[model samples]
Target: MEYARRFPGGARAADLLLCLAITAPLLLPDHDGFAPTGLPLGWMRIAAAPLLALAVLISRRRPVAAAAVPAALGLAASPELHTAVGFAVAQVTLAFLLGHRAADRPPALWLFAGVLGAGGLALLAAPDADFEDGGTLVANVLLVFVLPWLAGQGMRQRAELDRAGWQLAERLERERHLVVHQARLRERARIATDMHDSLGHDLALIAVRAGGLKVAADTSPQGREAAEELRRSAAAAARRLHEVIQVLREGDETAPLRPAGESVAVLVHNAKASGIPVTLDDLLSDGDALPPMTERAIFRVVQEALTNAAKHAEGAPITVTMSRDGRNAVVTVTNDAPAVGTTPPVPPQNANGHGLIGLDERVRQAGGTLHAHPTAKGFTVTAHLPLSAGAPATPPRAASTTREHAATTRRTARRRALHTIGLPTAGITVLLLFMALNDHGTDSSLLEKHKYNELRIGESQQVVEDRLPARQLRPEHRPARPNGADECRYYGTDPDSFTPAYQLCFTAGRLSHKDKVVLSRVG
Candidate 1:
């Protein structure tokens, strides 16, 4: 009903091309007559062109349903046009396009089955049609119809897979972009939260301590004046921090507010007191205290490493080393393997696997490099911090595409191209080879005038056969047998099977009758 939708310009063009192909076999001079079942040749030919054209137009939208049109038309022309090479060409072209155009895979396969069934039925319906033997019948069906349909189906699958691959790639890229954006937001939030809890608390405590010293009675007048200024400056710094942060709280709503600005030594001592075998090897007694950023970086590295060790390597001794290497301060925290027969509970912080991501961001913001990897016997996390304030860098963005992904795509495309082209090419080559090696349908030298004149009606059957050609006329080109002949064999007078043929009949092991039969109309 939707004429506009069903027959667009492109569909019209394809219909024109298909109609042209359908009429091609009829136009040949060798095919002078039409075979119509229960209908005139003119009527069926006029009806079939438009009907088959309609089927071709709808093949893309409805493959299985469109296939029935060709089947009905083929049966209508059976034993005559159905036997022509052009008829097979048109029908097989429809079958191949049906497979290539159908979107659903099951229905494409069904169309193949439908055409194959129709081809077999067409053979049975046209029992008088010429065929060399059983093998030729089956081979023709497979070669002309089944093989082309299968080739189309293979091409369709390859195209669909290629589209699916592109869709998957696009989806993964979307997910990657979203994940990267969310990670950046989460890491920045954690950094702000961490600074407020630890560094802000330290500033507030220093302001409180300066106020106490300024009011103490044992303090000298000059020391009191200096302490007053120190308290005022510390108070101003705390106010500025509060103004920027706008909200401050412990790491968790219920987590106890531990003393702020605890040195790395204090962190190691606390871990030791908590039943973790921890040792601190401090070799920085002679150097000036590290920059605030550097010191904070070191504290977080040790704290996170110790927490991980307690959670993963329970009861294992940990060594926290702080040594100066060149202008950078190096901190290494290593924990031995966990105790045997002990399994640690999985941690929930990095459930999304962003724990180390956050840690790496924290160290990078403090102008430091962090490395955490498996050791020979345990896990080790090392941080290298520049003692002087260096320009901080954000974590590098993840690559949007990789060489491996590109390589995989190229390989898939190459494989699809091969399947789309190679299958049909290989099938056609084998079909050609099979027909070449197995085709022995008609003998041109059988019914020569001289040979035909020498044959006698009362001759012995074996002697007649010996004198005649071994190859006989194909069934379709053979004419009706004369009555009372036990067996009839037709032979082509010329190389072309459609020319006039000689008919020989044998009865009771003796030649009984002979006649001239006209199998085709000469154009």
Candidate 2:
């Protein structure tokens, strides 16, 4: 009720601890009698059982002073045993605590069947009240009336299963922090749309070839070799804008495969310096010792398939390849054919360049697989990867063959870590010298007579076959020895004719196929 008037001293100390837990179970000793019924206990039934348990602890903050002071101090109290069991357990705990209070309006089920049908008709109008003791008045109306309505319906179903497991664990931790804050705002809007389409198409082709080399500086030698090829393509687009701002300020949390600044024959001679002819061939030599995330995921799947074949097949030739084998490395490429009547080019859809979705998330973060398609005679791509021993694809570094291949690759990685640490330290030194010679009894005095019968008297399979007679396992029988010519019982015997020994000792072995007869001439 407005949080019970902002907690009136915790609602008067929860109405004096619910009037001392309902008169401390009616001051404990009245097992239904106190001089049969002189009745009125001393201090007026302990001040009418704490004023009928503080009128059912202020029935939800005074439900009409909790129904006229616990039904007129339990119908003027003088009957007996703590005024008929503390006024029928504070009148069924003030009608199940004012039927769980939302500022109460509850009292109707014919007002608890006319107040428990007028206290079961004034308790069968008591003339010394034991009307055939009707099972002690139906066990005092189920212990002072339906055990507090089944303990207030089991504390309202365990407070609605602890408020539905704290609102389903706070809605699954707010949907896992809203899917990791929408994948870091989609990787910062894909590196700001690939740095605004590779530095706005190389600064608008070096500002239209520096305004046609300042109006043909002293008249065109092919516009000063196309304005010194637009100042060496704007100083190689300022070293690819400082290698894409040091790979977007070093983010893929370290995708560093650092060496080959350029290849696949200098990326098909820089895609024939963007005029797109390409062609390349085999390549490897220290392909950055393999894993710098598998050579930066096959060099961003061949730089986004040669920047989508120079922005969609502009003079296509393409080809490339790269290989390996044991523990794969592939790479492919494809291109060379779609120019005849020009119709193949598609890849330009760019709602923020995750160029072919960041080359399939950099070949699945280097756990490889890239693909791309289209090829009847054009557009391809591909990738593969997976290699590690601190990365390896080495081949062409020739300074004295790169110090004799780095001293034969550090003596073949120190002979594979000394043959994998001398095969498990010689198999744990032959299992600690066969468990220290089977614990001191050298080879076998029946393993020190089964470790002195497992420490004097136990483990009985007949004291382990009388101290292990060669670890006794001989009972599979065939004993008709004195040259009786019928010895073949290694399980399924067939020595000519003991009719598989009366079908395995009289069929106990479940004889099948006309019940056993594999006896072939062996007399």
Scored by lDDT, the top model is 1
Give the alpha carbon lDDT tens digit for every residue of 1-523 in model 2: 3333445567667666666766665564432112223335455467776576657666766644564455444434432212343455565666555544423234434344444455556556767756544444445445543465456556656656755865676676666556544443443344434444456566777867776675764857777767777777776776676666555543443332222355456656765875777776676644556754566567657766877776667676777788876686888887766577877566666533446555555555456666678867777888777776343322211223334544576679769978999899999989976864432221122123223324232233343345332321123443433232222121122211122421211112221111123333222
Would you list the clashing residue pairs of candidate 1? Answer: 130-476
Query: How does candidate 1 score on lDDT?
Result: 0.69
lDDT scores of the candidates, listed in order: 0.69, 0.52
lDDT of 1 by residue, 232-258 (tens): 998898778766554433234333223
Q: Ten residues in a row with the worst lDDT in model 2? A: 504-513
Structure candidate 2, residue pairs in collision: 263-266, 263-267, 285-395, 286-394, 289-391, 289-392, 290-392, 354-358, 496-519, 496-520
Q: Per-candidate TM vs. native?
A: 0.52, 0.28
